[model samples]
Target: IMEYKRGSTLRRGQWTAFVFLLMIVHQCVGDIRYSITEEIKRGSVVGRFSQDLGIDVKTLSTRRPRIEFEGNTRYCDINQKTGDLIVNERMDREELCGQRPSCALLFDFFLENPLELHRVTLEIQDVNDNFPTFPNEVIKLEISESAIKGERFSIDEALDTDTGVNSVQGYTLSANEHFTLSVHTSADTGKYAEIVLEHELDREKQDELSLILTAYDGGKPQKSGTVVIQVRVLDANDNVPVFTQSIYKVSVPENATLGTAVVTVSASDADEGANGELTYEFSHISIKTKNTFSLDPKSGEIKIKTMIDFEDTSSFELRVKAKDGAGQAASCKVIVDVADINDNAPVILIKSLKSPLPENSPAGTEVALIYVQDRDSESNSKVRCSIEQNTYFKLSPSIKKHISLITAVELDRETQSEYNITLIATDEGYPPLSSFQTITLIVSDVNDNQPVFDEQSYSAYVTENNKPGSSLCYVTARDRDWRQNGTVVYSLLASDVDGDPLKNLFLLDSKTGVINLAGPIDYEEQPIYELRVLAKDGAGLVSYTKVLIDITDVNDNAPVILIKTLTNPIPENVAPRALWPWR
Candidate 1:
């Protein structure tokens, strides 16, 4: 008698309950593990379950060795007479084991008669179904512009699930002029590759390049995956600079100020690094042109160096050059046109004069002094002068551009004390320039006027800390004489302050009539200072005024205590009556 337990439900054709019957005297057989290609038909042979398990064919045929999948599906069954385990259902390895290299199907088996317990494992072998693939759709690489030939860059390998002849076998890169593909076998038997430089990289010509890399397997009709290879080239010094234009044109005013911009030129370079930087300068220079124009090295700007004169030269030709850090250069021509502007004016400068003539002087006496000049170019600045028509005065040329207004007839000073004559100047130009100035003639008067000071005495006080050349006081004088005869000048007379010259201690502004401190003052040296100042008319008539300067004290000196005397040898001998030194 034997007791049995159900192994679970094992279906045959439809569905059947699996029961395990144990014969008290029966032995358990070793489990069988067999491999077979997937996608097999229902009648495919798995293995000889009877012989491999030590069971006889007669016993296996009668008892019937059964294999049921865990999900109640019968995948293999023994022949009822031959004891051969055969496939009972379609087996797809991809669905059964996916991409796993080691995959097996475990099922329960139950036999009758004496009853027995055993297990079987069916391993599904994989076939080529999936293609090789890359983890990324594109591979990015950066190459230096200075890269030399034969330089290699390692790239990631492609991945494939299938093993043996079905896995990645090789790698190939698309054809290019600068690079080639080098393939190597990785330690894991995977195909690895590197990009080798066939030629040096030049970013100036081409900064970026694109290519393709294909990973392929040895399957029939070969399956492969492609990844885009993108390469970016970095910069290096390789090219020279080039100007945008061969020539440039500019116009500027003839009287343009120094540093006036004439034109700006721009250039470009194809190479990077130091080769791309550009600088500008005058390529062709002439003495006359160089004196009048200059260029900025960094900005490529041409500027006026000296004042230009349209009448002297209306047009100029310049050649400019541009250079790069690599010392390569290019040049262009610059045509500069100087436009005329109204800048020059006729000038009248006094040369000689004899005004304030005697009342009863005869005619033909030179009375006015003058000279004329124009600052335009030689052709435009040829100036001439003439005195306006008048009854008592006439214009007469004396020397080069020099003229005098002379008396036309005898004159009487009492009847008319003065005469105003106009001297006119003219230049030669398109619109000719002219200017006029008035000259005054006065009748003579005797030396009957003298200058008198507005104040007989001036007093001022300055602090000890006052800076040198500080204004202390103002004392002006007046004269009744007319014109130059009435002009009065003030001066400081020789004087002594603490035995020092007064001029050393004070100074006066001759025309403004201002007295200023000439040196630092000290209240301790001299508290008060007084001196006589003189006023003189143009005719040598003089008068005098007194100036007084009081110096105030400031806390600029530190206090000091002095010791008159102290006994040296009598100290240690007798000290009964002690005495302190007087200070």
Candidate 2:
């Protein structure tokens, strides 16, 4: 066992010395193998790590071994005291192990008190669940007249190579006279059978007797052995009590109440009165049949003992024996089959469904496919699928137990972007069971709408000598399309007489469509300005609108008279009404 001392990390020199010492010690103790079970659920015990490592429990108590993965992921844990390794997470051979012949996880074992790294391989054993079988179909037993009553005989028992629940667990012998059956339990707890004589026999009347012994195990659908054994009464018994019939087959509803009478089996003796009188008792009963049925100790009647379920166990094979006061007995086989009843609702499975489907899909476009499952017996699992009252979608027949969700009408993303549809599945059972499933369908965006302007034209007024960058007016456009199709951007398309761009005269916010004065306004120069603005969307769709700004006039400018002089560019005139101009 590897010991990991938990404390401050040691220095490089000390670690190197520790490693050297460990290498010397490891050469003496060879590696060990640990066996574990594959497919074991999480939180289950895999193996005792310390025990498999040949470490004593007391030594393991001081140092706890921790299983560490590459990323320090904990898929299993180790018990400090017992050193047992238990699964902490789920493991899949095909996923983690893949197609490799063997899958193994190598982990570093850190021990507290003394630190050490030990490599261990856990071998996961596969589960054994094969059915049991007998090499021979029949066995012959010879009994002589000298054979005494109450004597037991030995016969070959069934053989099963598999282990665990897959191995033979018990035996069942069909009812017969002259011989009673007994099971021999092995040290491993597996069961085999032997034949015993119930009473003395006389050879004159009966020559041969026959019986069936079945060997069964515990597994899905169960596995078992079947064999025929013939006993040569080379001698016979006093007309062994005989049953009214050798075999009886019957059926009962699974809902049959406990203690309800199922079948009455009877046997008679040749001798009269008490000698002819007989009693009944069950033999070679199975675990499944024992819980479900009970037999009358006196009347040879069988009744329900517990709830009957066809799904769990369908039928029972029982042995009923009747013996006279003289000890002469006879037995018969009874097989009671449970009938199925409809009492469960259908289960729904969604196979193909797309979340957030694009809007405006074709009428026949598929939205989803629903599959229905039912547990009831035939004529019951058959189901019909339908969509709730929806104008946009409908359910169409696809295959058995499957229905396709198809669009019935053209969808408009603008009207409704998403839709939740309810699907109902109903079975053909009485008081039919039904189930509902809800799915959401989303409609995606498309560039189909043109930007809209708040108004075709907007009006505003500004005073002469108005400050620059003053808000004059606003123009807005809207589109109903989603995403990039609906967004609107504003731009200037006209300018003032100065031959400058309109953007220079007025600032327009592309997002809000607000227009601000870029330059001062003058009533004397320009009384009014007509601005054409364009709004465009990310989809390249555009719309145009206009803004009219009226500049109010103010009498602030005084009258001026200019006269050109002969020698200079500027001239002064003497008269106020007449002006002299120089070339």
Candidate 3:
């Protein structure tokens, strides 16, 4: 045997020989060549050293050594030439110590050394495990009547075990017209929803409402769940009351006693309960009386609380108010007329007056009469008259009961034309009412006057050729009576005052006092004459007077023929002697 240094020397020689053998083995395994087909299936592993050394690589031939990996770990790469596996770095030695490494560990080593290992093939399997849930299972919301359509209300939440689109995908509402929902995020940490009210709510019409909310997730198909929502409404006041009539009128008896009911008024309110209730009261009055009238608190019945006398009061005016329970009120006026009752007596203004005894007395004079008035029935109407001790005036008992007369004093125009006196009138009563009146008497002037002519005697002149109906001297008279009574008439009582009765010149105008010729006057037969005249009044009183008439001659009378004709001797031949004598 070669002398072997069994201690240090033998150790060195053994190291050298081991190194030499190790080099050879390294050279064979390290330089090993192998190729994975381009069409190699995932998770397929083969031993590269066994194929290169042409030896039964039993240890490495089973498949590629697998490394167990956990969450977020994977096989990063694999060596195609040597069939070396690469995996993530976090794999522990216990995972590698297993007789058959887990594929997860192989993925980890491949991922860890991805530069040395070029490729990795992993096949992760599916599992059915997680149930979908909501981030917040329930939601709450509020809305207003003023809210517009499609306004957003609030947001909701959901959760899911799966990720990506496999988590909560969308949301839905049962009452879509009233509300709506939409997904806010991509299932982040679970799922969430944004809810909105699709339509406005009117609290005045509806008080409360209900809604249903649902959330769905993306799975193989789809999955969904539901939530309930409750909503409440509030109230507001916005109404007014109306009346039936604008005004009311009533009539009541004047003698109606106190507390008598007159009439009732009313109004209406459309609201409910207290808001619609109405009441009545008096607002004003035309006549004020101390507690004389009142109204029913709720019914508005006008009543008389005190005595009403038509003798003193005729009508009453009242203003009434109708109020709702809401404190808003309206006012109206009512006229209450008090009917009349004839309970008063007539009174006299004048009691007595003096009597008048004149025929032509002026009007408005109290003469022989009494002023009487009745306060009772006509059967009780009685009046009497009497005159005090006076010789000139007397009262007649058997004649008119209230009349007096002028008896003893004879009315004479020469003595006195008027008389003013007094008389007394008395009625037949328990306390006979007596009154006195003054009477005025006037005596009228009778036709006892005689007409007096202007002169006792007068004269007039006339021409021989005076024509008939020619004016002569005028004769007039006077009387005491005025106008028609005092007027004097002219007439031929016996003969004309100028004594020309045969001369036909005795005509006169009674009213004008003018004398005129009744016919032609002949101066040869009655050159001068004496006449008589008469004057009278309508009362037939007459007076007489005389007048003298004198007639004068004029040349106008044709020359009473000393010679009937005269002739001119020389001019006879020229003009045939101017004229023939009258035959």
Q: Evaluated with TM-score, which candidate comes out highest?
A: 2
State which candidate, 2 or 3, has the greater lDDT. 2
In order of TM-score, best first, we have 2, 1, 3
Clashes of each: 1, 12, 45
lDDT of 3 at 129: 26
TM-score of 3: 0.26
Candidate 3's C-alpha runs over 4 A off are 1-403, 407-409, 412-446, 467-469, 482-487, 494-503, 552-583
Worst-scoring 10-residue span by lDDT in model 3: 10-19
Off by over 4 Å in 1: 1-26, 50-61, 70-83, 88-100, 148-151, 154-156, 186-189, 236-583
Candidate 3: tens digits of C-alpha lDDT, residues 74-98: 4333444444442323323223221
Give the clashing residue pairs of candidate 1, or none: 352-369
Q: Candidate 1: deviation at residue 224, Å?
A: 2.7
Q: How far is candidate 3 from the true structure (C-alpha RMSD, Å)?
A: 61.2
TM-scores, all models, native as reference: 0.32, 0.58, 0.26
Model 2: CA > 4 A from native:
1-237, 271-285, 311-331, 398-400, 440-450, 481-487, 493-497, 537-541, 556-583
Between candidates 2 and 3, the TM-score winner: 2
